[model samples]
Target: MTRSMCRTRRAGKSAGVVAAALMALAACSSSSDSSSHRATGSAPELSGTVTVFAAASLKESFTALGREFQRQHPGTKVTFSFNGSDSLAAGINAGAPADVFAAASPKTMAVVTDKKSTAGTPATFVRNQLEIATVPGNPHKLSALKDLTASGLKVVLCDRTVPCGAAAEKALAAGKVRLTPVSYEQDVKGALAKVELKEADAALVYKTDVRSAHGKVEGVEFPESARAVNDYPIALLKNAPNAAAAKAFIALVRSAEGQKVLTGAGFLKP
Candidate 1:
């Protein structure tokens, strides 16, 4: 090998090494940029109003969860319509504009699902039992389901169409106690209000409602309630305008943090 040839070969080897290094550096930079782009676009930004039609029984806990969801997602808003599950289901079936539906019972939930108004199968998230909501301090000393049967006890009850009313009837039947109510309110909250306002001596309501009352009424638990526990189911509406936010809200309700708020509000885990 001549000296000149040796020098040329050495120079060629140096160029090859430099070229490889440059290619490696370019590849690294390209990979970094691609990763940065993916990182920025990985999560789609969630923004919109999520309208929820929920049973009155879920008002307290769901409201808290809604606030938490909005906080976690700054650009999103949660609006809730709290009412009798039956009524809410009817509205949904009638093409009401709602993102989510949380019913007090599977029966009520089916009213929408059977109509094919829901996006998917409903999920039971919690259970609730009946309690006799009496005036603060239990002036009548109503201890059991039978006590509500006393003559002249101005007792109120939810109408038979609503979940609370249906549960109340189940509990009543379980106790084998026959009683006529002064009035059958359209919803549990209405029945509970009768007790809170001292209009009714006692009303068959949910344990959660009595607790949410914050001393406005007293709660009486009966063994019959165990047989009449109601299951709460939630689902996304097929016509949900804000599907993404609605799904997120449902996820939150089924999440540990959501369950914590619900359990803290006297609801039983599913």
Candidate 2:
């Protein structure tokens, strides 16, 4: 009887151990399945066209970046709508189908945020300072902010809605100089274009913009420019149909590769 009982007890112990092992194995299997499901469910594959609404000042650099992005992502076209920051913000607020927005100023970006048009918080990607872009050789001999007020110089400035115009206003306010422009251009490019086309003797534009213009014009540095530095902010649109692509593009813009290209085109990293 004792021997029979001992065998029975040992068998029972073995069964319990086996049962525990089976339970543990089942738990591990359940955990692994959940983990796999989560891993598979988290991130979707990214593709498609990314529509970017950018400030006019970003035209040159962003165009180059768009080309490079297309090279990296075959069949992925980047459609850009370049204009004044306010205009872009207004467009986004009006239900435009833009995937991303890159503005020349935080203040302008506020318009989007206020309207809840942004998918995420805006990130400052670059900083730009104003320079006096003038006709070749600066025939007016313009050198300072006050020089525009001199007799017989045709000056152009960005519209009050744009970042460059805001900077120009702040710079003028800081320097206590009043300048009446021949035209209040609708955008920064328009302001610079006036000088480039010889329609205006000079225009206030970002140094980066002037640099990108190459031989089209010459730039003059002024003291008050330091007081009004414009920060470039970029954000994904709230209604972005291609949110993943928009995020990827924003990452690329903030990445070292993007910075290299932007800096090369005269943008300063923020």
Candidate 3:
């Protein structure tokens, strides 16, 4: 073969080799980038149920949040036990199968934390102030904490052990008003229910509870509520059966979307 032809053939082979190497490198880089993307974008899959014990006043907001959490994690379910914060704390201390505990006050959360029943420090997520829930239309014109003490008014209150009841007591004291309810309910919902059912003329309950009532009762705000706002704390239980999901749920509760829902339901920001 001629030297010129030989050189041209060698050059062609060299160019082919270079092109192959470049293609191979490009493939490798693409594969590496794809792997990195998967590593960074993919998260561990979470499943199973996360049981939450929360104060009754959180019923509306929390239920909405729970539904959102389940929607975000298709395989997970959020079950809630809504009651008085004190009662829920007692249940946790008694070994209730709970994954999370959301109390209306730090004092009630302490009932569990004091026993080391939580995985980490509890975080305050929201605050709630007191309101007088009167029968719809303010029939008796009950406007303030003192108004609840009027003679012959059937007033209802949450039991003093619960956060709502405790806050009510503080508000009453702050107003320097004395009140004796016809009955003391176990949770804020129960107290609100008394007014809704017309079983009581008025009930001292959380503003959130009154808002959730949706015109079933009329809410009367008093200045004393500022002094008695209750801080709500949430924690993952130490023995949570579904810790992964529980932690995610807690994260959702503190997220901006969660705060929007809570604030819309009349809960105060923490």
Candidate 4:
């Protein structure tokens, strides 16, 4: 063949190969686009806010759980109001709007259920026992529930209506130890604060609270605590503004991952 004709044929072959490569690239791009669209539509889209009224003791674990819930359900937010269980129940009964309620004790949870503030049966997620929270380094060397009775020692207790208070009362009575506290706080965290701030030598609180406090306070476990183990109950509020998100939150709390977080924070599995 002539040299020019040979060169022309080679150029045509290269052009044809380039055209085939472009068509293959276009086909793959079209397939990927369709798959991306289907995946986007199939994935559940959750948005809005879920308000949770939880006990003071659950602040740490529930807060972590809420964050993980938000991670799994992007565009959703979890807002929590942590307080004394009895106080939260009263607020719910008084028509405070909340998507979920988690109480430190079943007795306190009953307050909300009795008022018909819950949609279904409350599930026990975890349990806690009373422990003495003392100032870091145990300045008073408070050993047991009875140690709070030492004269000149300023002790704080939870109010009779609070879950921690109720448990503390039961444990004290079981031990037959009677001592007047200098102050009666409304929530477990308040009682812990007294010890943390050095306002009180010791306070009866949940184990989880002491754990949450890190180095601010130290926990001293007592055998009498066995007499009043508190069960933490959670339920979906009636007519929750974000019912779907609330349900998802509760499911996460009951799921293995949630239990892992709770147990890591020193909560006993229910």
Candidate 5:
């Protein structure tokens, strides 16, 4: 072969090799992008029912959040079981079918995590403070933590094992007030219900719970509540029936829109 022809042929072969290398790199880049998208859940459009066992205090806000999540995810369904955080945690430990667990207190959430029932570290999405929930119009003019101790004023409180009860106790202790309740209820809602149904003159419950009652109950914020704040934590279950949906639901709860709803319902941002 002529020298010039040989040089051209060699150069052509080198060009082909470089082109092949570039193509291989492009293919690798595309594969990596796809993998990253999957890992981070690009689009995150999820389906299936995500069963969430949440604290009673979260009933109203979480129900609203669930509807918004379904609206955003189209086919995803969020079903919730709301009760005392301690009770829900116990149910989880007993092999309950739950995709996610949102507790009103870290202690309750620890019940699930300590049992190795969580797929990820729990996140504190909100904090709540206790308030005196009294009957509409405050006939007794109940205004402070100490007011519950008034003579003949029937009061109800959450059981000490629950978050609201724990916070109420702390607040009362901080204010140096001693109260004898007519009943110790299982959850914040139940405590608030005591006032709404007139079963008791007042109940120390979460500010959020009283707000959800929409005037059926009136809320009285006490200074001692600042010391008794409770953090609400959430996590996906280790054996979540719909892991992807559970993750998406949690993301929504931590989102700004979710915070707006929660704050509107009187939950403080974490």
Candidate 6:
């Protein structure tokens, strides 16, 4: 009776061992199935949001490009914070969660570089020249920076801290002209907006802005602008959450596809 009982116990242990082996085999099979599914490009998709802080003048073109990028990368969303180049640089330096940054001038970009906020060297993606923007029909006949100094002319200029304003000062100095503006606007858009609203007779702004404004303002080209050309620099932020997407977006802006759009909207390829 004791021998028979021992044999039964041994058989039960054998069955338990077999069950453990089978369970392990099943887990291995499921793992392999999952790996095969991923190998066949059935893995979960890549998707996320990226934040870009850009110069104020880039508002229109960058917004359009952001839309195009979304169309290309369906799962990615782009949010832009557009403001003065100096202000944007300050935000990034202060640890803003920016995936990318685009500035109107290298001077402003230097702030990011100095703070080590840029992932790599910022590239010159585009260039812009200054233009005198006035109300439709050439009411002021303000075709040049010198025209701003004429009596009864209400000229608006970007603040000295802003890139556009610095460029304007350089052009004015180069042209040997001095004029007092009605207001020193905080940004180029603000200066241009003043002209659009008829708050000022003339304003110095990017030529691209005048084009974007359409019937809102007429653009006047001056030769002095040649000396004050502003370069647009773009870079992926060092702490970017979506570094891959940021790089792809920057590549697109430097690509021929981007150049076409930028030029059409009045930006010169650098």
Could you tell me how far off, in angstroms, the CA of residue 95 lies in candidate 2 after the best superposition? 0.3
> How many residue pairs clash in all the candidates, one count each?
0, 0, 0, 0, 0, 0
lDDT of 3 by residue, 78-159 (tens): 9999988888988888888999999999999998998864546899999888888898899899877788878899999899
- Which candidate, 3 or 6, would have the higher lDDT against the true structure? 3
- Pairing residues by index, what is the TM-score of model 5? 0.83
* Better candidate number, 2 or 4, judged by TM-score: 4
TM-score of each: 0.85, 0.82, 0.84, 0.83, 0.83, 0.83
- Every model's Cα RMSD, please? 19.0, 19.5, 18.2, 17.2, 17.3, 21.1
Residue range with the least summed lDDT across 10 consecutive positions in model 1: 6-15
Per-residue lDDT over 1-270 for candidate 5, one digit per residue giving the tens place of the 0 to 100 score: 233331211112322432333333233334455456668886554789999999998887788778766755567889999999999988888888999999999988898898763546899999998888888889999777878889999999999999998988888889999978999999988888888999999998888777678678888888999999999999989899999889988987887546655666677899
* Segments of candidate 2 deviating more than 4 angstroms: 1-45
lDDT of 2 at 151: 86
- Find the candidate with the highest lDDT and give its number: 1
Candidate 4 lowest-lDDT run of ten = 6-15
Query: Could you tell me which residue pairs clash in candidate 6?
Result: none
* Model 2 Cα lDDT, one tens digit per residue, 1-270: 233331211122322432333333233334455456557986444568999999998887788778666655555889999999999888888888889999999999999987653557899999999999999888888889999899888999998878999999999999999978988998988888898899989999998778767668999999999999999999988889988788878987897656655666667779
Residue 194's C-alpha lDDT in candidate 5? 80
How high is the lDDT of residue 189 in model 2?
Answer: 89
Which residue pairs clash in candidate 4?
A: none
Question: What are the runs in model 5 whose C-alpha is more than 4 Å off?
Answer: 1-44, 117-119
Error of 2 at 197 (Å): 1.1
